[model samples]
Target: MKEKYLSTRRTYRESVRPHDGEVRFQVAVEQTDLLIVAQEDLRHEIASFVFQVRGEIKNWILFHPEFAESLSPVIVDDGAPEIIRAMAQAAALCDVGPMAAVAGAVAQAVGDFFSPRTPNILVENGGDTYLHSTRERVVALLAEPDSGAVVGLGIEAEAFPVAVCASSATIGHSLSLGAGDLVAVRAQDARLADAAATALCNMLRSEADIASVLERAQILAEFGVEGVFAQYNKKIAAWGNVELVALN
Candidate 1:
């Protein structure tokens, strides 16, 4: 149910079945650790499919083995949106090497579980998250050292159910080249949020660029995320509705 990948932060995913319903929920969590509800058989099947997809993508990245690969040469194996998103996030984090893709892979794998089924699945891996419904807001904890126990902003809402992921150097177990306590990426693509979180974290240097990073996070949200929140010094900047503000 919980796993730490390649010497990085601890990643957790689980399939929970409601005792009274014919539905099972599989959740992939990072800081937020959010989940959605769906039919049991459907949800369980998606979770299993994504796990296998994660294994394949990790293997694919091994062949390319370069930071540039993260930006391009995207692995096109057919699986699910979540799986693809995770692979892309990993490719972007290639600068950190192959291990960078682990979180994204798991997150994406979890998200992909909702392929055709809409409005009942949600997955948040390290902050980058994706949801099928927006009835509720997803708030997540940002692993920031100075942004208080809950990063800059605890939870945010967006246009739809969404993807929000975070990266940190001084917090959590994940490795980062930057000093930011938290780098939040809120987007529709769980993988992009994963990559952006790493990318943004790498850019975190001081309070000066915090504004710019926030702007970038906001810009990312416009693409589909709806909201992107980045916090480093207790100054929190968020874009979009911040769909889920309770995951934290």
Candidate 2:
């Protein structure tokens, strides 16, 4: 199903600054809006590829309607597309619906498509991201945009080809069952990071839920989640491999 982009200003995009030797561009196909930073401007290619990925997922959902509507994992039939399988498996691991991983999955799929053609790529869809870099990088956190807060997650060069995805009840358009400001997850797979972020965000109904959710993040380490960061109102906490840093 096609979804429309929000007309409201995407202020968080202001934080996506391109580094030296990189180019930044935006691609919007139906509901999938991506901001890409790469070694070269590949907007045309990225747009075509992401459109194809969304088409495949849409066509697959036509046969398996539950794959798009299920709030829990759904097993795809044989001959499912790789992106569909990735979303399904990640959702199963994080106990979230496959759609929860759609943004990150699309972003990573684009990264995968261009990896061999480029040495560095960063794809951000909605707020979830798929990053591959040869040097250190920092991703801005938009937990409370109204408060003028500035913070980010620092990624070491060693964590290349990683996904840092976020879910929030107070930001963007993604659905959430909790009231937390934000919950970000890092994983080797963008789908897994996206699904886990949604799953963890669903567990946070209040600031009191922060400690318990960070503990839960540790358990998720068994399922490819390298780290997690959570914010609820003025409170913030993190666990595992997360490295919080100030952002200008």
Candidate 3:
């Protein structure tokens, strides 16, 4: 039988004691409570990969617009492909264009995680996540509507590990397009998740913009997007391959 373990996914005002032997990394420092979970080794590695990938993205993408546009098609190309693909996806959102920042880097982050060993590695840099390996990973996503609480996403996996990422205007330091507190995206690769989350947030500039954004998201969804979580003007929506989790 397949093995599964569920730890105390915490949503207090402070970080929890991480599962034994897991490396700790700080993405951002804030004065408020943080949502944290103690997962298996595979999930931790994936998360680390996302952190590293996003760190690289912050180094490469945020300020570079032309180069990001240049990467649109080649994102699917291997060798750090995920983030590039994500950048291409993000480019669809703005008049200024994607320009290789948050979303694009997120994709690259997930891809970076998969680049190494084949363990069930999954990484979530803020909201952008990438998953690999054969084990099924169920991730709980935290959103704004739940009043800074945990929302459960009881996702069962197939033969491959999955990646998940989210963005928020009210939380974390990353940029967001919609005003909602949280937006998320899931894909086989972190780059896509990163790009999609950014795109979805962009779509939500206003409720008036929702249709166009969804249209654009769908137009790009054919690019093999698995799921989307978006909020604008105080609303949240989660699309395919996604579920919300609640942890008190």
Over 1-248, each residue of candidate 2 has an lDDT whose tens digit, in order, gives: 11213335666787688888898888988878888899999999888998899999999999889998999999986689999999999999989899999998998999988988887999988888888889999988777665543888899998889999999887767888888888999888999999999999999998899998988888889988999989887788988888888987
| Candidate 3 per-residue lDDT over residues 39-68, each given as its tens digit | 333445544655565555555555553554
Q: How far is candidate 3 from the true structure (C-alpha RMSD, Å)?
A: 9.0
Name model 3 segments beyond 4 Å from true.
Answer: 1-118, 145-147, 207-212
lDDT of 1 at 129: 53
Task: Give candidates' CA RMSD values in order.
Answer: 6.9, 3.4, 9.0
Give the lDDT of residue 129 in candidate 2: 85
> Evaluated with lDDT, which candidate comes out highest?
2
Rank order (by TM-score, best first): 2, 1, 3
Q: What's the lDDT of the predicted structure labeled candidate 2?
A: 0.87
TM-score of every prediction relative to native: 0.62, 0.95, 0.59
lDDT of 1 by residue, 1-248 (tens): 12222333333223122334435444442222334455345544554555566555555546645522443335444443444445554544333343455565565555555645644555544444555553444344544333324322233333444556777666667666777666666655565566667767766766576777766666554444445555565555555555334323
